[model samples]
Target: MSEISNNDDIRTILLPSAPFGIPEVTANDAEGTWGLRRLGVPHPDVYAMADIVSCTVRELECEGTAGPAVGEARGMELLGEVLKNPGKVARANKYKGGAYCGGVYLEVTLRDPTADKLIIPVWGRELKRGSMAYRQVIESAETVKAAFDEMIEGGSRG
Candidate 1:
C-alpha cells in the first residue's frame, strides 16, 4: 500500500484582539449535550470551550455549594420550574425558544446511577463551541452552579 496519505494540516489561529469571536459557526444543539460535553472536551483549539460549563459551575458556587438534585423530573416539569409557569408552552413537544436571540431550546436528560434519567426542558443560553455566545453563557456563575447543584446524586447499590 502507498504511504498513508496525510492531508490534514495543523494550524493555529489568533484572535484580532476582539472581545471574543461571535457565532461564526452555528448548529442547533437541540439537547445542549454537545455544548455540555465541551465541559470535558479535549480539543486544543485554544478558542475551544472545553471548560465553558465546568468553569461556570465552579464560579457559581453559593455559600454552601450543593450537589446534584437527588430526584427526578420530566422535561416539562423542569421547564415549568425555570419558566415559572410553562403556561401553554409546557404541553408542546419541540422547543425552539433558543432561536430568540441566541436562546436555546434546551433539553437535558440527566441520569443517576440508582435512578433513571431526568428530562429537563428549559429555555436557556445557546452555546456554540468557540463562539462568543458560548462564552457569555458560561459567564453567569449562578446559573451554572445552580444547574450543577440541582443534579441528582445517587448511591451505588453495591
Candidate 2:
C-alpha cells in the first residue's frame, strides 16, 4: 500500500474536541487529514496508535481519569440510537495499558460524502486535574447534544 499522504484521500477522522488538548491526535490515511483538538491540560502518560477494528484511533492515556473511554462509548451509543444509525466511536484501549486513561478518537470510515450530515458537536468546561479554571468533562453523546444545544441556543461563554 502507498504511504498515507496529507491529501483528501487520507482519512482524517474528525472527533470531539479533546479536553484542553491534553491528548492531541492527528492522522494521514485514506479518510483525509484528521485531527482531535484537546482543550484542557493533564498531559497523557502514554500515547499510541490504536487499532480499532480495521481503523486507527489515537489512544490517550492519562492519569487521574478512569471513565472517559467508557463515557465516550455510552455517549456514542446514545448518539447512534438517536441518529438511528449506530456510528462507531473511538475509545482508549484499557487492555493495552490505558486503564487510567480516558480517551477520544475518530472512526476511520467517516469519509463518505453522505456521512457529512453526521456532525459531531463540541463543548468546554472548567480545567480539572490542575490548579486552573477548567475542569475535564466526560465526552458523551449527551455532552455533544448539550454542547450543540448550547451553541445553537447562544454560542459559548468560556
Candidate 3:
C-alpha cells in the first residue's frame, strides 16, 4: 500500500463569531456561530446547544406493539418524540440530588437518501412538575432548533 495523501478533499471556511450582540452584550459576553453563548444577565431561561453530538441507530431485533426492528426506526427521532411530549422517565441515580433526578432528553433523527440514519441527542434543562420532568417553564426549544441548525449548516461536520 502506498501513501494516500491528498489535500483537495479537505477545505476550510471561516464564520463570523462574537462575544454578544449589542442589546444582549455585557462587559464580557460572547456568542459563536455554533450557538455557543456567554450571556450578560440571568434571564428566565434560554436554550442553546448544550453539547453538540450525533450518532446512528443500527438494525436490531425485538418484540412489542412497535415490535422489533432496531434499524426500522431512528433513535434520534424517538428522542424528539420523548421531549416533544414528556413521558416515561427514569432517574439519574449516579448524579447528585433531586434536581438532576428526572432529567429529559431529545433525540433528533437525521439522514440523507443514501446515508445511514443519523441520531442526534439534544439535552435540556427541565423543570420538575411533581414527579414529572418538564422543560424549564421559561425555557424555549431554542436549543433543539440550534442543534438542528448546526446539523443542517455543518452537514457531515455536524
Candidate 4:
C-alpha cells in the first residue's frame, strides 16, 4: 500500500475598517439572506432588514434637513423624526466634529441574534456655497429609499 496526502490552500476574506481600531464587517452576505450560519444565513434576518430600514430612514431624514443652499436648516425637522428611535439593535446619531471636521453623521445599527452587530454610516458635509447640497440630499434620500423598497418588495413589482 502507498501513502498519499491531499494538499490544499485555504482562502480567507478580508474586510475594511471604519477607523480608530473599530472592527469591520467582513462577512459575505448571501443574497436575500442575513446573519451567519454554518450551513448558510441564520433565522430572523435582522441584520439585512435593519440595514434596509436604517438606510430608508436616513434618506428620509436627509431630505427633510436639506435646503436650497449650504448651511440652510431645511431638513432639521425631518432629521428629528428619525432620531426618535434608538436602542441596541438600531440607532441614528448626529456626529458633531468627532473627527476630520466632522459635520452631520447619520449612523444606523443592527444587532443579529448571534450577537453580531452591523453599523452603517452616512456622513454628510455642508455643501460649498451655491452648491447642490439640498438637492443632493433630497435626491440621495429618494434614491436610497427607492432601492430599499425595491429590495423588500422584490424589485419594482408594479
| Top lDDT prediction, candidate number | 2
TM-score of each: 0.19, 0.19, 0.22, 0.30
* RMSD, one per candidate, in order: 18.1, 18.5, 18.7, 15.3
- List per-prediction Cα lDDT, in the order shown: 0.27, 0.32, 0.29, 0.31
- Model 3 clash pairs are 19-29, 19-30, 19-31, 76-107, 79-107
Report the candidate with higher TM-score, 1 versus 3. 3
Ranking by TM-score: 4, 3, 1, 2
Question: Residue-wise lDDT of candidate 1 within 1-158, one digit each (tens)?
Answer: 01112223321111111232211111112222112212223442221222122212211122111332212346867666547744423322112322223232222233323533321212133343456754554443334334333221211111
The number of the candidate with the highest TM-score is 4
| Number of clashing pairs per prediction, in order | 6, 27, 5, 3
Give the higher-TM-score candidate: 1 or 4: 4
TM value for model 4: 0.30
Candidate 4 Cα outliers beyond 4 Å, as residue runs: 1-30, 34-46, 49-119, 127-131, 155-158
Candidate 1, position 78, lDDT: 65
Q: Write the per-residue lDDT of candidate 4 for residues 40-155, one digit (tens) a residue.
A: 23332233433433433332132223233222224875455446533311212221211122222223333334443333332344332234664554454354344444444542
lDDT of 3 by residue, 28-137 (tens): 11232222222343441222222224422221111221333222346896566557643321222212233332223333333333544322222223334343323331
